[model samples]
Target: MSTTTPPTHPQRAGLHRILIVGGGAGGLELATRLANTVGRRGLSEVTLVDRYPTHFWKPLLHEAASGHRDPASHHIEYAALARRHGFHFVQGELEALDRSECLATVGPILDLNGNDVLPRRLLRYDSLVLAVGSVTNFFNVPGAERYALPLENVKHAEEFRQKLLTACIRANHLREAGAALPEPTVNINVIGAGATGVELSAALRNAINLLSTYRLNSLEPERDVRVRLIEGGPRILPALDQRVSAQTHARLAGLHVDVLTATPVSEVRADSIVTVTGTELASDITVWAAGVAGPPLLKALDGVELNRQGQVLVDKTLQTLSDPRIFAFGDCAACPSSIVGVFLPPRAQVAHQQAVYLSQSFLRRLTGKRVDRFTFRDAGTVVSLGRAGALYQGDFGLGLRSLIVGGRAASGLYAFVYRRHLFALAGLTRMAIETVSQWLRARIRPSIKLH
Candidate 1:
């Protein structure tokens, strides 16, 4: 590892050195917010570290995987964002942490061909934030890690898209040549019927329909493509209201996506999946959206307490139990919920709220004022169903009781949530311009990414 320090603005005395690791939703927003506030005011030296150079919203990965959304259009470059927001951006992975010295070790920068561009180096910090987010949890299921594709990052989504396209083309060619095939259709098995899996299934069906209509003319989408959403729970979207689940399940059925609930997958093979009931189903492609656990990198944090799910144990203030200077949030930190004996769910809303709270908390910290405990306010949940529309559940101003909404109103609300994220990051002007640009692009470009 090289001993040279990564390029950053020289730190000035009396400025609080705040280091935030992980450029996901929470980390990036916090960096942008604090950079615009305290960093701009010369009160703190804000630095954001991340493994990747660009930031893409995780909630949109499923849409990218289904080829319904183009990731390049939405990804934000850290360097450019930092320049505009007045924060130092460090491009490297956080490998280890030393609380006593208040330092973080970032791994070396590596090129695509496996050569090191820069050696591992240490970053000094007065305060540290870990928002590295979660990773796919296979739960020790046999052959799952090897056979299933995960949607943890942009690369994974693109890989799934390319493979889906290739499979469709190959199947169409076979049909056109009158060749005998082992299976009648190209089967796509999506494990777990959470928001990700359900949305992906719906998007996949829409993509297949568009592909058949435009590109793969020889193959009929209904006859040649099969999308299956398998879940272990009694119903899809088990976390949401049962009414929402029932409506979503019915809509998926109308879209011809087979929804299998209460059927846990015991094993995932290269060409098939074996259920706990000893049933084997053919699968050309499999996506694992089963569950997520805290990233394993948290283990390297010296003496930090971790729960069984590998999440960092933090108090209401979002500070680690072992170290007050070290903080964590988003999906990586297990913060207590309002309900007794339960922790907050790993949702984007939780992360966004924590980020907003942290920005204010930091401002208060600079003034030597009391830092407020973070509280989560549920804005509700919306699941996209592509062109078929969307389903929304949660308090929609109906006195805290959940309201179920469907069709265009629900779809518009679903879109507004994403726009809100953009608004938070880029402000009103840029967000509005971007929204209009994307709308215009949709008119000119194909509904699905062709290449």
Candidate 2:
């Protein structure tokens, strides 16, 4: 194994080094935009470091989990993206930080067989940005970590998809063998009424319908497959308006999803979920999408001040409270909101806007100009309901009420949000090309991944 200390890249010696950790929606966009401006003019050397070699949008992980979207087709390699956008890509996890020395220690990269692929290295940076994102917050529920699957990344999504497929196939074989079967041969319980849980439950129902029609003709989707959504709150989407929540619940009913509000999970077993009310629900697959908190790495960030949720605390300028040279944003940072004592919500739009704002702030810094405070404009929320439809509530600025939209038009708006993210990373020409390619591929390939 090899060890290296600082000076990781061979760039211009006098240029300022900007190191960004994490390649989520916000980090990648900031890297691309900054590379086009400051990095292009040789004012600073930009480098993006991520544990994964590829990036997949976190918002769409639910679709991947339900097999509605293929992970491989949508994944963007960091190396290729770096070459196109004029930035450097480093694949490593940030393990330690030294605020006094302005240095970060990255852990070693290992292969599947536990062999070393890359040695531990140190990266020196003039400015560091942390966007490492969040992880599932189990809240200390008994057996949740061991039994419930969390849709935090691509691997978890794919694992859930495969297990779902296996459960369906196994049930079909049991029926063929003339064995006595229980009601709802396959039971899937998703604990959470948030956007991820709601969207995933709908997607799973749709996938099951398609599978019964196309492949598992012997199995009846409605009679044999059950999808249950459990929420501790009084209603689903507790964060949104009451009208929006009511509309979404009705739409879910149309898709035959069982929504259990005010039902808190007490324990998760390998084959069952126990609620706080002492009700035991038999579950073939259990998904935890209830909540998220900052990753454990944030706790180790060299005296960085974090909130109760383990998210780094940042001021209006998005810089960490402990050090000005270090910054945080997206799901990892608890950025102050316009409302007193409230942090911004963890949404893709919020991150996208923050990325744009940070890029401009960096450019202004070089000119010795003042950096303005970051403000987030409410852009509304959109929820996907598979092929049935979607619900969208638009936030009208000022004192005007929000606009509620439903059906196909709402679905189109949902698609546009993802395309807009792509446009930020790649220019319009490439984004358009990617759009056309996905359209073509959908026509040729199976709707769901068989494997």
Candidate 3:
């Protein structure tokens, strides 16, 4: 394997340097696990590198975009996590990779004014893990990248929320002054009926309702606010069970959300979206959640085998085919499934399971023990539908084929998924404290963010 000293922080002798790129759910969890175990025992040197200083669960990006959740209160500081756990944190974007030299170059950090803040640096690793995750794919649609907003990161989510607020306020002013408005109402078009699209559509409806209730805007939630969820597929949540999809569809309908299926968005204009069937839909704000592709850096990496979707191709052990020393998981890796012939689905649960597997694999490797192939356990799926509740479709390990539930029970199960993630990152005590804190905050603060 290629070997080199880190240009900035030289690796000490004997310690196996484990450098993980990306601080997403999988990378962060793996780093924490290794830090608490092998890292704490001085068996390996673990470091996590990410572009952002904080991490908020990607599943909650919809809530952030709809202003239903305050990101500041929920985000975990990377530095803080590193300090609490036994790992190092590096904040920078991955720029280039030199597989032969075993060096990964991080681009220079710049300020908002384009001034250089930190020079480019090289990081060397005995083993490298790429969990950089995926970004929105516009499918070569004309004007899509420029006109539609993508909820991929915190900045994007915040920007979408601000834009939504601005649109609502502007619409409210036009109505109040009785001016000839461009449209009689605010139209929001969400492309994609996947989990993200469906959840965001529901959250937006609830947000609009709350805003109208507080008299924050002059637009009526039931009349002047129109949310249309357009999907190219035959039905919403195509990856999920049909029962869950139907239940979620019903919940969205109850919330006054327009569900349009089998209609593909051909082009996204600044003020409207055109379907493949030559139909134009009015839109004040458009959100793109149709599909995801791996980060651009993955395709640029030399020698790394990638799938058609640009995801790094890995074996069941999550090791890259080109280099066993390099690994990838999460949404960035296309790991083959042992059960089905297809690759594993890109879901938070899949990443969580991989993280757990990798952590143990590292331990076994360090001890010169046999590392078993990774096996994915089918734990079912849950789709949240805002205040209308959620839909749960999973076997729950009862050896049953499937069990479907909705309403409050499903909502509780949906929450448990996130809570379980929290339990993994933080222990029971911290998770409890966070749960109580959020509950108390909900009691006092506004249900939605106004600013």
Q: What is the lDDT of every predicted structure here?
A: 0.92, 0.92, 0.88
What residue pairs clash in candidate 3, if any at all? Answer: none
Q: Model 3 lDDT vs. the true structure? A: 0.88
lDDT of 3 at 178: 87
Off by over 4 Å in 2: none
Q: Which of 1 and 3 is the better model by lDDT? A: 1
The best-first sequence of candidates by TM-score reads 2, 1, 3
Using TM-score as the measure, name the better of candidate 1 and candidate 3: 1
lDDT of 1 by residue, 75-121 (tens): 99999989988899988989887778887888889888767797787
Alpha-carbon TM-score of each model against the true structure? 0.97, 0.98, 0.96
lDDT of 3 by residue, 208-301 (tens): 8887777555687777788999999999999887878888888899999999999998999989999999999998899999999889988778
Query: Against the true structure, whose TM-score is highest?
Result: 2
Give lDDT tens digits, candidate 2, residues 339-381: 8999998899989999999999999897679999998988899
Residue 152's lDDT within candidate 1 is 98
